[model samples]
Target: MAVSAIATPVAASSGSFLISPNVGLMLWTLILFGISMFVLWKLAFPRISEALDRRQRAIEESIDAAERTREESRELLEEYRERLREARSQAEEIIERARRTAEVHERDTQAEAQARREQLMEQTRREIATETRRAIDEIRREVADLTVMATEKVTRKTLTEEDQRRLVEEALGELDFSALAPAREE
Candidate 1:
């Protein structure tokens, strides 16, 4: 009935933006639309929807893989940073240890030098003392010999061994031996 109403043209012209449909034409158009809808539902629509679903899943999986890769890269970066920090700290510790070792070596070297200097000084002092004793003994011998010669000249006779020994003893007794020797600290 609606198709018949649209197909019947009005004798009076109305100011409306409408076109009348022909009855036979509207009936054939409906038949063609139904056939096309049936064919698409049976074959084309199912394949198109399946393809769209597969494409959507593929896109989602790609996004997930990208996210995983980004997370792994972040973890690697943090690990590398930690290793760098450790290496720097270890280097600092090694440098500090080397400095401490150098300090110890310097102190040991200085102490050893000082000890060697003291030992050398002591040895020199001992050598001087020995030389002084030898010089003093030589001088005493010379004085004793001169005194014996003078006594023999004065008496106008050669002095015997006994007389020479007695004269040397008297001269040695008169002198202070302690005063000629070096003073000891201890």
Candidate 2:
């Protein structure tokens, strides 16, 4: 019994909370602590936590910038569209003004041409009436001379001054001098 007690003194010490230096438990404890630290730093802390934080911040910034740019682009497009509409209205107004001016110009030119034609036609008619009157007078003088000669030949008698004048007047009474035809000089 005394020899068994001496041999089992190490076992008896194990029953206490203290451990011996001769056991390899210290090495196991160090290995487990190193592995837990490695897992925390390499897998848990750096990969999931920091990367998630960076990604979330980046996404938020990108969304904000995209919204601002979209608003700016929309405003610019609206401004350009307004300018286009204004230009179209201005162009239409210009065309209408030009059309009105052209119509006025055409009317003025046509009136001028019509006035000129009327003046020329009236002047030509007046000239024709004057020429007809002069021609009728000349023809009457020639016919009277021939009649006097014929009368002297046929009657074998010379007419007196009063009879010749009366005969010539009677012959001219049948003709209208105002409406006489133009004389052709032979």
Screening candidate 1 with a backbone cut-off below 3 angstroms (N, C-alpha, C), the clashing residue pairs are none
Candidate 1, residue 82: lDDT: 95
lDDT of each: 0.87, 0.82
Worst 10 residues of 1 by lDDT: 10-19
Show model 2 residue runs off by greater than 4 Å: 1-53, 125-186
Best by lDDT: 1
For model 1, the superposed segments whose C-alpha errors exceed 4 Å read 1-41, 150-167
Taking all chains together, each candidate's TM-score versus the true structure is 0.63, 0.42
Looking at candidate 1, what is the lDDT of residue 84?
100
In the range 32-94, model 1's lDDT, one tens digit per residue, is: 999999999999999999999999999999999999999999999999999999999999999
- Top-scoring candidate (TM-score): 1
